[model samples]
Target chain A: MKTKKIATYGLLVSLAFILSYLESLFPIPIPIPGIKIGVANLVVMIALYGFGSTQAFVLSIIRIILVGFTFGNLSTMMYSLAGGLLSCLLMILFKKLKFFSMVGVSIIGGISHNIGQILMAILILESASIINYLPALLITGTITGTLIGIIGGLIEKRLKKFLVNY
Target chain B: MIKKNDFILIGIILAIVLLIWSLSFFKINWPMNFFMKTEGSKVRITVDGQEYKILDLDKDTTFSIEQENGKFNTFEIRDGYVDMIDASCPDKICVHQKEIHYDHETIVCLPNKVVLEIIDGQVNEVDSVAN
Candidate 1:
């Protein structure tokens, strides 16, 4: 059982890495910076629902660090760390509450992710005016988070049986 | 399947975003008619939170900025307008942005951490007061 868990997590990490790579391939160009679909969150969400918070957190960190080294700079790593950690935290909290389904949780995650990134932006730029981008970032977050939630829900439904045995 | 509450949440988020976006237009000291009358004769450039250079819009000239890592951005000040004509950043979003000459308007290149903001007059007293 222990070995199975390790193997499964490793596979999930690779899946997330691949998803991140795929997202960079065809970026949706909006006029704003730090905006993307963040498809890797789908894998993280799946890990959360399947194996709980510990597994989800592990996968999130590993994916961010590995991807940051492979395709990003120091600033990118910092932004990703801030956004990913906050997003994951919110996802776990919402999931525990059980008031909302996967979709709603994902939306919350997305919103918090943007908030986290903007916080980092404010700190790095040392300008409060950077907060002006909040509304736009939140809107983009909502749209992308909703999409990720829907996709995660479908994936979870299909893998439910296998996940239970694992 | 999405629930009724989910739709409500979406509506709330959309409404909030729209509210903030619309509110920005009415900010005090920001002339509603930006194009009709423009102020601010100086542009402040900063990189990675450090002041790089300041330029007077009254003088028309072109200059290039090369960063420590060999990345660069080129700017042109013509007819009292500042425009980023070229940049080494891959996205080129900064290069494609339109020129600016209004107070508080900013052009930001995220990858390069470069910011160009316009301020009114010789001194930024209003900005200090607001802050």
Candidate 2:
């Protein structure tokens, strides 16, 4: 990657980090656990569609870490890490499978992140009882993920007019 | 076509969220837990997938459950609470949760694959009599 490209990616990552933190400050009307209107993810979904899977993955992780550090809440870091990794992985995999469109990838990413985090919570708690919470998380994930993805796809379609080739 | 798909995705996500929220919100009654622990020589329990029950009593016995390698983790009961003490997984979030004893409380350790809860059971004879 060229230095200029690296700088651009870094900017993208920073921008995403800021957005994620900002979204955290936004109150999600839904009271469901793990439900969020993560506006930062909109950028990530766009990057994945316009750029490449690898770049998007890097962006997601950087955002999570940056948000985690800024908030100084090391405890919830694992949840973020697990969710981010799973979402990115699923998005890329689905993209390779020709799964619908960028919006679809974002939905998959959102749902997978929730599933991954629940799995993380289940494993940590040594209790399957909480599995009942899945339906709620998945539901919220789908809604938020799809919304972000659609926004991303729109942005990507517009950005395609530029000289960027993923 | 992409626009239509986006609408469908959005609709699906919204439907799910609504369904889940309604179910969670209107849940009139909580479910019961079958694995209730009693005071005995051995406190056998499962954590994450490993089964570790403690013998030789302590101040306040707390059980932490975790799972590892498709097996339930056996946690150590210490300090009137439970801790992973040892595990094979890379993350140990369950071990960090504070001990819980209330009927509705639960301790979740994600890495170890354990979910320790105060299983609902009939109160003991003495407590039952008191009640």
Best by DockQ: 1
lDDT per residue (tens digit) for residues A1-166 in model 1: 9999889988999999999999878877663445778899999999999889989998999999999999888987888898999999989998898767788888888888888887888788865455656777888899998999999999999999999999
Error of 2 at B87 (Å): 32
In the range B41-124, model 1's lDDT, one tens digit per residue, is 989999988999999998999988889888898899898788999887886767765577776667767667788888774444
- Per-prediction DockQ comes to 0.28, 0.19
Candidate 2: C-alpha lDDT: 0.63
Candidate 2 error regions (>4 Å): A29-33, A163-166, B3-131
**Tens-digit lDDT track of model 2 for B12-115:** 76776666556546642223233543432223354435665433324544333333345344456564344445444443434444444434445454434345
* Clash totals in order: 0, 35
Which digits, one per residue and each the tens of the lDDT, describe model 2 over residues A101-155? 7767777888888887777765555555566556667776777776787677677
lDDT of all the models against the reference?
Answer: 0.82, 0.63
